[model samples]
Target: MNENFKLLNKKIKILHLIQHMKIGGGQKALTNIISSTSISFEHVVVSTFNQYESELNKLNSSFIDCEKKNILKIIREEAPDIIHYHWWPGFKMIPKNKIPHNCGIIVTVQDPTPVEDIQADIYISGSNFINLFQKHIDGKKRIVIKSYIDVREFTLKKKKNTEIIIGRHSTIYKNKIPENYIKTLLDFSLKAKFIIAGDGESKIIEKLNLEIIKNNAQNKIEIWPGEKIKEMLSICDIFLYITPDDSFEGFANVISEAMVAGIPVIAENKGGNSEQIIHGKTGFLCTGYNEARDFCQLLIEDRILRLKMGGNSKKRGLTFDHTIMGKQYDQIYTNLVKLNNKEKQ
Candidate 1:
């Protein structure tokens, strides 16, 4: 091995414990950090549910499937310098009193609410908005680590069609499509296409379809299966979001993806969306149905404005790329390890 590689291998090891390896917000972020920091540190991910093998299989790091491996046994064997937990549920995999006293613990909370069940050496909030409602558990320094968006994954393709394509994606059950928003979309049925992409109760989809039929907008609306998010985004000219009041996005990943794809977003002004979207620049965050409708109309009417905002959105989205987050995590890991070593001495 080269000297640099030897040095990297000898550096403090990090064990990342996550709830699952499924393709979701938390899992994606964990995989991105692992991919970004692979060359600089020794890393391993221990997941409770390994039903879906992640794309991270291509990486050099190891993954311990909870089905076959005992997590506490692996922790003792590896003697990792730092243990980072991704989501709250991942904590259940660890036996309460089994953690090594010398190991530095870091828990990244993806929820908008303060975590009360577990204590850690360091805490990371999933977003700046989420940080507002959270408390510093264990009185540790709280760091806000926003979700990283991979700008390269989304191609910047300008809107080509006269028919404006508005897109949205999420777990449909958690985020309800406002009835008034649906009515507003139907109002432009002649000139626009509303594309909804996500997994939801079949009955909910059927009900929405019936509503579209009642408005004579059957041809203007398409509800896609959740798997086709990338394809839907590629064709969309603008992203429209209509979420319920109670819904809180730790960080709206799909909104960032749309922005990075060179599409201006019109999202609900609630939750962490305000942090992701710069109103009147990247996109518009609207408070009411009228504001959202007006924003959509503005984007539809002015192609130049759409292009400008889309470009700004991409620029803003690039700042949230994983490479930047990886470096930040590296710094935190280095400091925490150094502190732990000093305490031991």
Candidate 2:
């Protein structure tokens, strides 16, 4: 639909509530959604915590940084058609009676667990694998919509023939990498260059540094603060997505980003990673460190297989476009509004 036509219609006012607009999967996903959505939808972001200036300024919608006590007041005053809550913290902050019964409540599930006892008209999940594990949500409308990116921007870069670059980008605090996993990565550092990118507590970084030093793999292992991820993925030949046993990664956006950059991934067979990796095709899903090690080594040793898998990854990654994702959510919003109107009549 044309922008002018969309503008002429009665726009559905959306109050998107999240904990913070930090550099994370859910935050970026919401940003992509609002930016790609048609002008017919009016989006207002309400964050309980602080937001990154760059990310907050990027959106065209109005943003509100409010205290817990004021959140319900803002919602009631704004009287938005849809309350699209993302984070668990955001869900907890909602007061029961503040929202009018006719208002549509939609909760976007980004973690393995949804907020218990929260009343929502629709529950939006980012992956089918994550949705399968959801037990907290009852009798709510469920829809699976995977995270998306503009795959075109992350073009494939020809990796160095002599050196294979293995990269992993994540908030390390949530990652519960076993000591044995570190040893396994160090073992791979013997043949390939390893890059661990992401900012975390100083203690965690120091611990990782100590592990690298103890293994005498400092030359091959590079641990640094996270930068533009696409830049990191461009030179990377393979990606390592090993999270702890109890990881709550609803949809691993980093895995999708790496795939878009034509990099093969080897992820732990848990969380939303199952939905992203095509096991043995686009990438491998391993059950343990041993399995992960074998897959990593295979990609490192076989150049032809690496290229083939990378191509397949890109092909699969292209299927997840942000524009398409926005349209799907738009349809859900439209239906919810119609349902609300019908109930009133």
Candidate 3:
């Protein structure tokens, strides 16, 4: 048997270190990876903040509460063949000398900003735009492994009502919910029902609510808690996403989720949104709120065009499915382990 095949026959253990198990892009990415990876691989997730105990149980993997115990102690005890760090803030605090040399280190860059004070054998980015920032990180290899979603979970269903539902889902940070985007949604408030779903800072939520009230568009625009994303996408005819001119999305997993759910996406032409959306095909990428409004109106007016774009979106979205992501990670793990073993000899 080939050396690589021999290593693959045995179980490969991956220890995932994350800042928190909270409901966010990074946590969701980790969940998709763990759930989709091959049975030949075993996963153990460690959360630094120890939030979401119930969510961790669903992963079907061993969990370590970092708040209760030292991470180095857990690392030594688990002795993972590969240590994968998501976001990597948790790894910054750990002493480099304490980490076992035998295990390979992989860091997934979840944010657009360049990371510092962290060393890894491999650095994985979610998009080409993010990979540009990771060029500064010295690694054996820097690769783009786009964030993924489980497509089976998203259902492509027919719209039940004539009401045009425009939706956007995110963490609801102030920068994410831009004042200009809010104005754009208000522009079409009468033609469509807008739903902005996600939990975030209370002050930001209040500010949005106040804007809706000031415009007297509360009935037209709804602010929902960020749960049941599939249900949200199922009802929405179009997924309209916008951030401030300055702020940029790393990958926008919500856009991919909406695309797979068979909804046309109208996102800002910034950051990784350009990569996820194909202009005028899978969806439209707008330079400003005016272009977004124009695209939104076009989709709302033409049902056939909307469905056609949606169909295209689903076809393109499957390319980022979690299974594909798992295979890529599996290859990375196998190659790294093989290389590490060779170095030992």
- Report the number of the highest-lDDT candidate: 3
Q: In model 3, which runs have C-alpha deviations exceeding 4 angstroms? A: 1-9, 49-52, 88-98, 138-140, 180-184, 188-190
Clashing pairs in 2: none
- Candidate 3: worst-modelled 10 consecutive residues by lDDT: 88-97
For each candidate, the alpha-carbon lDDT, in order, equals: 0.75, 0.76, 0.81
User: What's the C-alpha lDDT at position 169 in model 2?
Assistant: 85
Per-residue lDDT of candidate 2, residues 2-88 (tens digit): 553354368889998888766567787788778777777888888755455565566668888776558777877888888888855
- Against the true structure, what is each candidate's TM-score? 0.84, 0.88, 0.90
How would the candidate models be sorted by lDDT, starting from the highest? 3, 2, 1
- lDDT assessment of candidate 3: 0.81
Error of 2 at 72 (Å): 1.3
Q: What is the C-alpha RMSD of each candidate to the true structure, in Å?
A: 3.5, 2.9, 2.6
Residue 210's C-alpha lDDT in candidate 1?
80
The clash number for model 1 is 0
Report the Cα lDDT for residue 226, model 3: 77
Residue-by-residue lDDT tens digits, candidate 3, 1-345: 446557556788899988877666788888888888776778888885545556657766888888898888888889888898887433463434459546888888878878654557878998888888877766446888988888887756755766989988988876677765556677754488998888877888888888888888878888888775556788999999888777777888889889988889999888898888999998899887778888998999999999999999999888778999988887888898888778888
Model 1 Cα lDDT, one tens digit per residue, 1-345: 435334334666889888766546667677777766636578888885653354656676677886688777878888998888886532463433458536888878777776644557778887888777665554456878887766677765544665778889875664465555557677643356889988656777777778778877767888888778888888888898878777777787778788888788888888888888999999999987778878888998898998899889888877777778777787788777777778888
